[model samples]
Target: MNDEQLMRYSRQIMLSELDYDGQVRLTESHALIIGLGGLGSPAALYLAAAGVGTLTLADDDRVDLSNLQRQIAHGEADIDHYKAQSAAESIGAINHHCRTQVITERLQGEALQHAVEHADVVLDCTDRFESRDAINRACVAAGTPLVSGAAIRFSGQLAVFDVRDSAAPCYACLYGDSGDEDQLTCAESGVIAPLVGMIGSYQALEALKLLSGCGTSQKGLSTFDGLSGQWRHFGLGRDPHCPVCQWRR
Candidate 1:
């Protein structure tokens, strides 16, 4: 770390868990974030600001005027722009030292697998169940840790699936392969803006912990109800019949 880096991250480095060595680990790690919308926005910002060495942002959607309500990574000027590119610009503004790669398309198949393999940690910030399932499969295949989050209406969910751990459950184990075509989205059912920020920030926290090996993984599922202002956490069990991860057992 140079003099500038030392000063820039001095606060985090001061911690016992994230001393110089941990900070170095974070600086040498790569994070893959799929989605540059509500959940991906805060996750990418925090990861970049925290000095993740490399960030790969993948999102096929363009920034809509409605996104500025919760997608903190983009602004009015970025409306109509590709979300991946807009997010990269925001990240660059916060941390010039953090290298960013933008993939302005939805990733799947070999491309998704390659991205998962390269990343030290993957953040599944996408909204669709299909994308989440694909990401989970790729992470499980590559034995990479995944931080998944979702927000809709007044509720949000978060989970960490460390496929490197034999006991951990993959996303498929929790939600299964069945597609919920009628699932409510932020667009369909109005969302509270801060709900996404809360979940996305937690995703970033989990990624940092996984990357630096500084904290215990928050295994299982965590759900938040904005209306009730309460959080519920439950242990997750691997399903024996899970198609995506059954072979692991």
Candidate 2:
């Protein structure tokens, strides 16, 4: 690390767990973040500010006026810009030394698999279940750790699914392949801004821990109900019959 780099991450490097080596690992790691809305915004910001070496942001949506309520990565000036591009600009402005890659196309099929395979950590900041499921499958297939988070209304959820641990549960095991919640979305229900910031920031924390090898990751489910300001943590185990991981075993 150069003099500027050292000074840039001085505070984090001061942590006993992150010291010099851990900071180096973080400076050499890459994180793939899906979605550029509520959760993705804060997640991207924190990752960049922390000096993540490379950040590949993927999103096909354009910034909308409504996003100003919680999508902190973009401002009114970015209103018609593609989210991935807008997020990259915001993150770049925060930390010019960090490399930022913007994928303006929506990730799906082979493209999603490629992205997850190359990333040290994958963050699912998306809202739709389908996208989350696809990203989960890719992560499981590549044995990459995933930091997943969601926020809607006054509720938010965060979790880490690390397939590196044989006993850890893949997302499909807990949520099932398909369910009744397909119709639910934050757009219709509305959301509290900080609810996303809280959960997304946690997602960034998990990603950094996974990347730097510096602390215990969530590796399970943690739910937050912001309306009452209550949080819950639960242990999760692999499902012997889960199609995603069953064949691997």
Candidate 3:
């Protein structure tokens, strides 16, 4: 890292837990963030601002006016623009040193697997169950770290899965292969704006932990109730019969 980078990350480097060495690890790491929606917005921006070496931003959808209510990375001008590209521009503006790779299409199959395999950490920020399922399978197959988050209505959820550990539980372990709550989306249920910011920020925190080794990533399942202003943490274990992860066991 250059003098500018040292000054750029001085505050984070001040921490004994994440001193200069940890900052270096962060700068040398790569993170793959799928989706550029509510969750992905803050996750990408925080990671970029924290000096993640490279970020792969993937999303196929274009920005819509309704998205402005929660998607913090996009503005009115970005409406109809591809989300990946818009988020990439925001990342660039926040930290020029942070490199970004924008994929304007949804990634799946071999492409998804390839992206997960090469990343130091993967952040699953998509809304659809199919997208989350595919990402979890890829991460499990590649033994990659995954930081998953979701928010709808007044509830939010977060979980970090280090698939490199055979004993660690994955997203599927928490939500099954085909999650029944497909219709439970912001569009359908209506979400408060800051709820996503809270979840997305936590996802970034977990991703940074995975990359910088500053702290242990979150384990198990964490649920947040915005209405009650309460958080619940529950232990999560692998399912012996989980179709996506059973073979690993």
Candidates in order have lDDT scores of 0.94, 0.91, 0.93
Q: Candidate 1 lDDT, tens digit per residue, 1-249?
A: 999999999999999998999999999999999998999999999999999999999999999999999999999999999999999999999999999999987799999999999999999998888888899999999999999999999999999999888888999999998868888778888889999999999999999999998989897999999999999999999998898998995
Q: TM-score for each prediction? A: 0.98, 0.98, 0.97
Among these predictions, the greatest lDDT belongs to: 1
Per-residue lDDT tens digits for candidate 2, residues 181-220, read 7556888899999999999999999999999999898867
Q: Model 1 Cα RMSD, Å?
A: 0.8
Candidate 3, 96: how far from true, in Å?
0.7
TM-score of 1: 0.98
Q: If the candidates were sorted by their TM-score against the true structure, best first, what order would they fall in?
A: 1, 2, 3
Off by more than 4 A, model 3: none
Q: Which digits, one per residue and each the tens of the lDDT, describe model 3 over residues 1-249?
A: 899999999999999999999999999999999999999999999999999999999999999999999999999999999999999999988999989999987799999999999999999999889899999999999999999999999999999999888888888888888787645878888999999999999999999988888888777999999999999999998888888888885
C-alpha lDDT of residue 35 in model 1: 94
